[model samples]
Each structure stands twice: as structure tokens, then as C-alpha cells.
Target: MTSIEHITLEVADPTAARTFYSTAFGLDAQVRLRASEAPTTGFRGFTLSLTVSQPSTVDSLVATALAAGATTLKPASKSLWGYGGSVQAPDGTIWKIATSAKKDTGPATRAIDEIVLLLGVADVTASKRFYVDRGLAVGKSFGSKYVEFAAESSPVKLALYKRRALAKDAGVPADGTGSHRIALGCDAPSFTDPDGFAWEAASLTPSA
Candidate 1:
């Protein structure tokens, strides 16, 4: 079964990013700074979705992230889908905290139940096909608007959405170019997806 294993976020300051993630989500340090020659001016077209067990947990996380220097993109609020919100980490990585208050079949956790890499792609169908061809099994999907890939042995799920829609979801502008802020760690041979998302071949390292 295909699994994400790990997800790397390119940031201007790896040390600061590592600190922010650790403080905000109790995630271990796992960021690599961009080379001096690399330009750091793109949205990365993705958001890290952290699924928690309940609404209060979502609020607590959003608050923690904000206190840790994350910029609030959307304050925690309840919608028909559930209670959640978005924030931009100090290093510019967008993080989404969400909860449906549903019981998790996965291991019980007080804070984060799972982490999902949500990519904003120009062509959802094409990108979906790209991963499906590369061994990703489709989970729940809604036409070309959104799609989720099942996580087998991996703790993180991979998902795709229309670029503009994802921007709206993250409460950020959709217009972006250059390096995506995130990278997928996988064993499927390093390759770029149709929408320009890169997957690096690497072993999984579970975060704290």
C-alpha cells in the first residue's frame, strides 16, 4: 500500500519553522531550509490539514498556533461541515485545523488525530490521474472539486482540490507561482505531478 511517510515544507528559516511546528502542534522538527539561490515567494499551493477529535481541540490548536506566531487566516468557527480554521505559520506554511467531532478509528490522541497534505491544483482530474497512475487509491471524491487518496500504512492522507477553491478554503489569495511550500515524502520514485507538486522518494519519519 502507498503511504505519504513524510511531508517536507520548504521555509526561509528551517530552525524557526521547526520551532513553530513543534510548539503549535507538538510535531517534531522536520523542515529543510531553501537554498540561498532558491526564491521564496510562492504560496506552495497547499495546506496542512490536522484532524483532531473535537471542536474544543480545534479551538485549542488554533489558539496555540496563534500564540506561537502563526498569523490567523480564519478564526475557528463552526460550519455545516464542522468546526475549524486556518492559519499561516511563521514560515508561511498554511495550516488548517479541523474537527467533525466524529470518533476516530485510528489511535486515540488528545490533540491531532491525523495530518493530511491538501494540495491546490489547477487541474484536479489531471492531478488525481497522476497519483492514481502512480499507485494512489482514490478514497472519497466529489467530481473535480475535491478528492482524497486513502492512506494505507501511512499516517498522512493526500488530497487534491481546485486551485481557487483551495485558496478560498485557506482564506488566502489563489494567485501564486514558483516553488510550492510543501513536498511529499514517498517511495514511488521522485517525480513531479501534473500540477507541479513534487514528491521526493524518502522513508517515513513519524512526527511527535
Candidate 2:
């Protein structure tokens, strides 16, 4: 099965980004950073998500991220689907930490059950076809609005959303240009998706 073995986020300050990610969410091997001067503005067209076990864990992770210099895009709150919030990291990457369980099952452990990368695409149906041709099996989908690819043994799960809706979900404007400043480390041969997000061989990723 296809898997996203790693993810590389290009930032202006790789050193600071490394420290921030490690300190804020304790991410290292799953997410990597490399130096880049790519010109990008407004929304970068994607968001990283951390799915935890319960509401308290979501609150704890959001609080920790804020203390580590993340800016609040949305305060942690209870929603119809669950409790969650969005925060932008120091490197301008938006992260949403959330959980489906409205109540706590145990003490907050800061454990992340899954890491998801949601790409904001122009056409969900078209982009879905692109991945399907490259061996990604659709796990769940909601018409043209959303689509999730099966992750299997991968460390990171992949999903697609309309550009505008995704931006709103991240609490940002739905306009952006230049590079996505992110790359996926995958098991398949290196290729660029229809939306321009680059996917490369997992072996190219640096050690965390």
C-alpha cells in the first residue's frame, strides 16, 4: 500500500522551525524542515492536523503549541463534530489539533493518535483522479468537497479539500501564490500532483 513515510516543510529558518516543532508538538521524525527562500504569501493552501484521543488532549496540545510561540487562529472550542482549534506555527504553517471524543477517557497524555496533511485543491474530483492513478486508494470522500486517501502503514495520512473551505477551516484567507513550501516523502516514485504539491522518494528525507 502507498504510504507517506515522512513530510518535509520548507521554511526560512530550518533551525528555529526544528526547535519550535519539537518543543510545541514533540514532532520530529514524522515532520522535517529544510531551509528555503521560496516566495509565498497569505494561505499556503494546506494545513497539518493532529488528532488526539479527547477534548482535554486537544486543549493540552493547543496550549503547548501557543506557549511555544504558535499564534491562535481559532481558540479551542466544542463543536458539533468534536472539540478542536487551529494555530499557526512560527514558520507560517497552520496546524489544527482536534479530537472526536467530547469527554476525557483518561488523564491527558499529549499523545497524537494521527497526523493528517490536508491539501487545498482547486478540483477535488480531478485531484482525486490524479492520486488514484498513482496508487492511492480512496478511504472516505464527500462529493467534491472532501476526499481522504488511505494511509495504511504510513506515518502521515493524506486528504483533500476545496481551497476555499480549507482556508476557512484554518481561519485564513483563501488566496496564495508561489510554492507550497512543503513536500511529501512517499514510497512511490517522485512526482508532482495536479495541485502542484511535490511528492518525492521517502529516502530523500533527512533524519529527524
Candidate 3:
């Protein structure tokens, strides 16, 4: 029954990053982290997929992000996968605002229903094994193309995809440099995934 307790992202300006995410996505500001030294610069091969219940929620969130200083990577539109778009936050982290539900203009709460931390792995099959070995249960799979892990009590859903395929899906280039700038809070002993994504054990959980 493992789950992602929290996600930490390194930002040059934690205060501003926190503000942008909080205002745009209703994410708790405390999740943002400020490194004592300069953090790496460039694209991080991952995305925070905020899943909402209503179709209109996707548009609303995308609009809120842009107005709050995010750069649009993709405009809101209907797609076979769902209705949504992608954006790079003020701090350079990517986010995908989407919903699988049918189009509806009904009101939605600012709080996100699910936060999926999707990693663009060099090998999806290998990455899936890494997490499973670390205690996350397999939730769904599509061979090497995609895989999802079930979270216990944690709200964040962890998933993996082929690095290049993921970039194409998000309409962005695959090239990246320096740190991925993402971390996961889990019950497993602290370790880095094959692609260098770190997982920090939650305090309540003992080391394996």
C-alpha cells in the first residue's frame, strides 16, 4: 500500500513558484522547495498532470496558468485522449491540465482531483520494474508505451512513458539538460529511479 506523499521541485525562486502554482492550480504552496545553491536550468523530462472531473475545468485551469505567468506549450483543445493542454510554469516545470470526462461547463472546485507525476523514462518497462520493486503496485500497463502505478493513501498517481514518445505527446522537444528537478515522497528507502528521479521516504515510514 505505497503512495506518493508529496512532490518537490527545485526552483530559483521558491516564493514566486509557490505563488504561481497556488494561484493557478490550488496546489499547496508548501510543496515548493528552494535549493541553497543554484538549481539546474532547462527542461525536466516529466510533467505534472492535473486531472479534473469536468471538461471545462481543463480550460479554466489553462487560462488561470497563462494569466499567472505560465507559458503555453499547447492550447486547450479536444483530443482522443481528452480535452486539455500543456504549459510550463514560471519556474520551468511542465504541467498538463486535462480531463477524460465529456464536455461540461459545470462549476468545479479549484482543488485538483488527482495529481499524476508522469516521468518520461528512457525505458518504460524498466522504469515500471524499478518502482514496483520499490513497493508501488502496478495499476495499468500498455506494454512499453505506458504504465501506471497505484498509490495507496497518497493522492499522486505515478506513471512512466517512453522519453521521446512523451515529449511528442506533449508537443515539446525531447532534448533536456542538467537536473530533472523532481522528487517523490514514498515509503520505500530513499533512492533514485533509473532516470535519476529521486524518491524520499516519508517520515512515518521506516527504512527498508
Find the candidate with the highest TM-score and give its number.
Answer: 2
For candidate 2, the lDDT comes to 0.92
Per-residue lDDT tens digits for candidate 1, residues 131-186, read: 88888999989998999998877868889998888989999888877777567778
Local accuracy by lDDT, each model: 0.78, 0.92, 0.79
Question: Candidate 3, residues 8-55: lDDT per residue as tens digits?
Answer: 877777788878877898887225465424446555788889988777
Backbone clash pairs for candidate 2 read: none
Clashing pairs in 3: none
lDDT of 3: 0.79
TM-score ranking from best candidate downward: 2, 3, 1
What TM-score would you give candidate 1 relative to the actual structure?
A: 0.88
Stretch of 10 with least lDDT, candidate 2 = 199-208
Clashing pairs in 1: 44-180, 44-181
TM-score of each: 0.88, 0.97, 0.91
Could you give candidate 2's per-residue lDDT for residues 1-208 as a string of tens digits? 2889899999999889999999899998899888999999989999999999999999888888999899999999999999999999999999999999888989998899999999999999999998888889999999999999988888999999999999999999999999899999988778998889998888876754
Q: Name the TM-score of candidate 2.
A: 0.97
